[model samples]
Target: MSLVEINFDGIVGPSHNYAGLSLGNIASASHKGDTSYPRAAALQGVAKMRGNLARLGVQGFLLPLPRPNHALAEALAYDGTEDRALRAAPWSASSMWTANAATVSPAPDTRDGKCHLTPANLVTMLHRAQEWPDTKRMLEVAFGNGDHFAVHDIAPVTFGDEGAANHMRFCEGHGTAGVEVFVFGRPGGKFPARQHEQSFRLIARRHGLDPARCVFIEQNPAAIEAGAFHNDVVSVANERVLFTHAEAFADQQGAYDAIRAAFPALEVVEVPSDAVSLEEAIRTYLFNAQLLTLPDGSMALIVPEECRESAAVWKYCEAMMASNGPIREVIPVDVRQSMANGGGPACLRLRVVCDPATVDPRFLLDEAKADLLDQVISEHWPEQIDPADLWSEALTTQVVAARTALLAALAITELD
Candidate 1:
């Protein structure tokens, strides 16, 4: 089975300035504390996609960690290294879980917002759990299938003290046998905004992932402007897939161009863009793996009411759809806010695994299946990611299973 493990956020920090304030333990760019509604909605969007994948017989699901800062803090405090080296780890450990509320972090104020430790913990549990039949086996399978590396909007780790330790625990938990970290180190101990393209190639080789199948594509944290990593960059498709986006309507032509050049051999289909803006339409284009043209002529796109007449979107969609075979179905989704924060439906979902075996037979055939599964995936993105063909087959599967058992036990005890 072919799977794509996606990490949200090409760089750390929420991109949308308008996204409600965060209300977790750590403070953020926004005046509002951690656990903001917008952030929750973003996570919800990704979660929704996982549920959709389950229905599609696609075993993959998004493996999401805590917020960027939250995760960064975790790693900083516990990567079994010094503070400087830990901080240099490729990604940050941000999260919406308020450390203050859970007594996880000694924030200046804990009562200011609602907080929960479960989301981040669950993320860790989901990613690291092992074996099938484990309580959260579904979560592990959906998120654990990754060898070759790729990421979406993932932020770099940046924090001190307990915050750092929590993030490290999460990363370490996922750093089991098959999982490979695709992040990179920054100079002077700061996470750079530029795309860490080198990390993609490096991790692919380090983990023994197939370069012919692995891929990492994402928006560079360095520039929310147009032309970040899009214009001219390419990498070998080492046994994995990584794709990221930052509002298409913005200056991201370069980023698009890079992807086009990267996956020269994959089948790409263009569809229609009926969304309100060009960015949303284009983002749909990327996830559908239709950014570039397939051997056929049609293009695949997300059909939204607003983009019915978008010439570029329509033309590409029509071309991809019209290619050798008809274009795949047009998926409708609501991702208006994601664009503001450098994300579209694809960015929000974070695909960790794809169950090729369970996927609809139609996906394997030349024809498209008119079903909600495709729609759900196009909409939520992460709900369908699976970590492996079967959780039992993975090396870390046992660990995850153990963790799941512990969690179930703890839950039962709490209930009593």
Candidate 2:
């Protein structure tokens, strides 16, 4: 199978904003500042998501963490057995990442060097994932045993950190089928900030990459605060295009047109606001970039509620037709709980592996449907009907219920 690498977003324990307020044993809330829902909900969400993926037959992957912080440690530690087949991508996690070169700054004198903390953790995760037979066997074949690490050895200061650089390295290793990174710049995780264009260009050059393939997306209104347009023509020269969608840009189509004109070869797609509400635009954009289908016929979809709304669920279904364009599929997820800090679906979910060929689909069955009828018969009609007969009827009812709920969720959740 062509290597499938997806970033595992919701894989970690439920991630809650703990800017303030606390819920019993769970840490205090940040960013969004809500402390009502227990962290258990997020944890359950992760488990549910994993089961969904596992059932889908997904295995062998890479996880590029937003930040390899203590929170990640806690999340992973919660689920012991640190399997090593999966590699933890360090590009976005390591603090030493600078846009100009791969090397760490501040003269690199201290042990706790800003970049050290996350890289160490990332490497640990990578090692753990690699230890597993599936991930180990596959990765060794792809990058050549340990040869992948050498790509990261180059001290390019351009990409911000080892995590992000490693991500770039993996992309580069893929040759024609390499990765195309779309860095979502906005208010919440505004690492590159307004200089997204400059940052991406510099990072691209440092990595011996063509800027044309890199995409820079500005998704936050606050990042564009003061109404300053950060779109630059120079950056567009490098294929580092900007993204402006109704759900993300306050000026939606205007931003889209601007980006479109800037990079003629770069195709700019319209994002439905209802597909990704203003509050969840950042995550929505990430979902589009990371999980959505690539031009090649494979899906990297991140299906949030927004996709169903503006684009229409049927349209999304149509879009996923696996034609000459890209393989597409809706990622069934809910982000209503995570929208407090201006993030929607993407913010809450992370993509660990993206190669579509690796998806395994065994978990999409309707277990809930089985439970409902069983409950009714056991409670009232226990001796009246044979168990097998009841099961037959229940299975039929369950299928209908599952399909209806899925369609309903898609219809109700959208970018608006």
Candidate 3:
């Protein structure tokens, strides 16, 4: 069976704002209460997707989750008035970073020979905790092929599952069985570890992956303290290549040894501590880049523009590109809006390996669909949204109308 990895990116929502909601996310906190350009943010995300599809020739897209999250306010026993609910509800546009969408086990690894996805419970942060139910609903609609796809519920709340943000898979090819790496964070430092060890184990067991092909590793507390909120902030893997910082994990050597023992051909690319400090890595979001296999059988690093601007990161990337390394080139994408919110190129997407035919047609993207989305974003999305405007009836109407237009264009009736 032929298989390929599709990148499904979440469109930025109309209510995208800087509420400084996430505790561990430095950018979110730093930019709290600042004015946000929701229309520009959505268009920037679309442009990135368009470029990826044009360059890589394969990509997919997911619609933004409904914003203002009035349901959450209602659940909290807030009055049903729109103004009251909007005022009380937390504005969460974090769903644009789809890496936290789910933990996907490809058909080759699962016992049932069907791809499985379990949405992250995301119980650590209140704003994020409200995403799972809507996320699960969207996932079910997008991956509706019952014979080939299995959409599972969110992990138990106590487990604190953060989904693909703390997961990586390595294989010879997308069609083959791969080694799944689950990186959990332990709480003992200044910054709280968002992922729980039990959560990692639970996901592995739930996926039914072979014991020999699964490895669990702990994240380095030092990295977390340096503002690496998610494993993706300091490490990312693609195929057989694992790109990471020197202090990314608690047992760096042990983790490497285990991975090598499982997949002998694995290539471990470690950026030495002296060359790039954890502070620089987090600032440039170097590890948050998308390591992709291009159509020419060579790999490319799709990084945020911030990496190119950082002298240290740019120097390292130039050296890497010059060498005969697995990464043949570096492609910089402008996602400044998302970056300010603590997400980068990799965070914006969820990677799923499958036969394209098995996915729901509405989730897949083409040039025509991209054009339509561009039109929707340009014509209907809000130009700017201040924190104080979150409760405005006019803004709510615009957001709802924009989403309705997008759903219609995508032929996604379930969301409508």
lDDT values for all models: 0.27, 0.30, 0.87
Q: Rank the candidates by TM-score, best first.
A: 3, 2, 1
**Candidate topping lDDT:** 3
Ranking by lDDT: 3, 2, 1
Model 1: lDDT of residue 146: 35
Residue-level lDDT for 234 in candidate 2:
9
Q: Write the per-residue lDDT of candidate 3 for residues 18-104, one digit (tens) a residue.
A: 877777788878887788998899889889888889877778988788876777777776564555324534567888899999999
Q: All predictions: root-mean-square deviation over Cα?
A: 16.4, 16.0, 2.1
Task: Give the runs in model 1 whose Cα sits over 4 Å from its true position.
Answer: 1-55, 59-193, 210-224, 227-326, 352-416
- Report the Cα lDDT for candidate 2: 0.30
**TM-score of candidate 2 to 2 decimals:** 0.41
Please give the distance, in angstroms, between residue 390's alpha carbon in candidate 1 and its true position after superposition.
40
TM-score comparison, 1 vs 3, better candidate: 3
Candidate 2 residues 222-341, lDDT tens each?
423312112210011112222234444434555445444434444433335464343343323233232333335344444445445544443544654544433334454554333332
